[model samples]
Target: MTNDVIIRRTIEWMEGHLHEEVTAEDIAAQAGFSKFHFHRLFQSAVGMSFTEYLRLRRLTNAALALIHTDERIIDIAMHYCFDSQEVFTRAFKKVYGFPPGQYRRQMMSLMKMKEEKQMEETLKGWFLSGSHPFNYEMGADVETVHQGKQSGYLKSKTVTPAEGEFATMMQQFKADRYRGKRMKLSAFLKTEDVQHMASLWMRVDSASEEVLQFDNMSDRPIQSTSNWNHYTIVLDIPENSAVISFGMILSGSGCIWADSVTFEEVDEKTPTTNLQTEIVMLDEPVNLAFEES
Candidate 1:
């Protein structure tokens, strides 16, 4: 199987068996990779170690349960395989920047206020537009969130024959802080019956809004149907970059859900998926022969 398929299946298995206590060996076996090799590969592609990813996913699910249900804190902890409430609380706080109890209370309060105000579920810091806005719908959704009671969703509302037609929810901001650095954009995505494809995209732009570096996950497109999975795009923001823009895009028919987006500075060791290729300058042209170096 392709590495992408293997990774997807491994993640699916991890999601289904989150409540169980499984080690790296088990996960590697499930993915059909040796434990040692999988460790490196998983960290490289997913931007985190297997253990860390598993723990964070569990904590994320626990966070959801905390907000959605009235279950006891300790019970929720146990359900996700935490050895004790204290351990769970430490992990949860580290990841979410708040204790479980506090997170629950604060999120519940905010959700309540949103509902009371009858606020439309919309992305606040994003600019939503598309080639055919009339043929698509985009908004934040509370009912079908991946975590924390809300997620940004997009769906094609009407059929269109234009191959170039697309709907996108995007955000752009000054690249001052990230200039001359490698940045990774990671998000969890879920899709349904995608007619064309869906992708998480990022681009570094010059002052004139010309794209300098870009990756729309085109090398490995998310097409057809898919369950919730983590996807990421990494790009270098050159010193000349002025803005960074990114978001989810959908072409043709289908729906996509995006949640838990994150950005981080990465070292050069992380391969960039930028569509632009660097040109190599040769000292002299020599290889006119059939076989020569």
Candidate 2:
């Protein structure tokens, strides 16, 4: 199997066993790799070590429990396999910058305020636009998230959207820092009842508004319902590129949640998903003669 597939399967396994005791040695054995080798591979594929990923995921879930449930903090911590309340508290405070009690109180207040405002609010650094943007509601979803306290979401407001109608939640910024580099955009996405399609998209545009590179995952669109899954788009930013724009687009009816979005520069050895690079052109006209066939 390809390394990507192996890593993905390993992550799925890890997610399923998050509540149980797991070790790198055990996971490596299951994957048919030495512990050391698997550690390196997992880090390269996931952008973090296995132990760190596990800790963060556990802490994220614990945070959710703190927000959504009235369970004792110690119980929530123990349920996630942390050794003790003290250990969990220290780790949680280190990441969240607040103790469990304070974090829960603050998050609960924020969530209550968010629900009161709901669709009337706009996500900072993002805007809604598409063929029929009014037919959709885009905002932060605190209840359904893949990681962290909340995720950004877009959902259809009407059951009978006009044919060919669509909407996108997008952001654009100066591409000066990424120019002349291969940049990767990664995000976890979940979908429900996506009738047409949904995709994570990115584009690099030149100063004249010409497309420099772009990919919308058209060849592998997300349709129907799906659990959270990691997706990425890689593209080379031309030196003349002036803006980088990206977001999730939902076509037709459905809802999609996006979380943990990130961008990082990658080595040239990493293949780009830029759709513009997929087209083939000849340096000069060839095979003009019928005999060439």
Candidate 3:
């Protein structure tokens, strides 16, 4: 199997066994890799060591419990495998910048105010559009995020969506600054129950809306489910390009969270992920007659 598949499966296993005590050595054994090799591979694939990822994920879940449940802080800490309440408090405070009690109170107040507003607020600087946008809900999920305070999400509202139905949370802007440059778009994404597919897409268009370059990661779609992983697409912005558009797309039923989106210029050594291929036109229609075959 590919390294990515192995890491994803290891993350799934780690999540399932969070309530129990498991060390890097045990996990490495489970994955059939040596301790030192697994440590390096995990760090490279995830951008963090296995222990750190586990701690942060556990803290994230604990924070959620603090917000959504009345569970005692100590119990929540213990449930997530923290040794004691003191240790949990220190770790939680280090990441969240507040003790559990204060964090819970502040988040609860903010959540209550949000609920009172009773309206679906569109994510700023982004819009939703697709084949069946009404079948999906798009929003900023502050509670469940890959990093920082929030992450943008697109989730299927209807389980029985029609075939080929999809939705996208996208944005477009003038491409004047990026013209004639190789640009790379990267984001951290997590998926759940993605029945069909999810992808990060980008397109460079001309003044009249002709696609000059495009890639939707169709060759490498995220399906079923996956833990937070970084994905990237690179394309050259042609001189005639007028607009640059990009977003995350979800087809069929599923949920996807996107965070830490970034765009930067890359050197010529970096290959473009553009899926558009050159088209050759024939001089004339050669198969007009049925007997030609």
TM-score of 1: 0.72
lDDT values, one for every candidate:
0.84, 0.87, 0.87
lDDT of 1 by residue, 1-293 (tens): 75656777798888888899999999999988899899888876676887888887788788878878999999999999999999999989887899999999998888888643211335677766778867877787765555555788888877653787888888888999999899989888989888888999988889998879999887888898887888888899999999998999998888999988999998998778899877899999877885885
Name the lDDT value of residue 267 in candidate 1.
97
Of 1 and 2, the candidate ranking higher by TM-score: 2
**Residues 1-293 of candidate 3: C-alpha lDDT, one tens digit per residue:** 86666876777788787788999888988777998898898875556788888888788889888988999999999999999999999999999999999999999998888752211464777888899988898888876776657789999999878999999999999999999999988887899999999999999999999999999999999998887766878899999999999999999999999987988888997678899999999998887777875
Off by over 4 Å in 1: 1-9, 19-21, 31-49, 62-113, 116-122, 146-149, 159-163, 278-293
Candidate 2 residue-wise lDDT at 5: 61
Per-candidate TM vs. native? 0.72, 0.85, 0.77
Shift in Å, residue 276, candidate 3: 1.4
Error of 1 at 212 (Å): 1.8
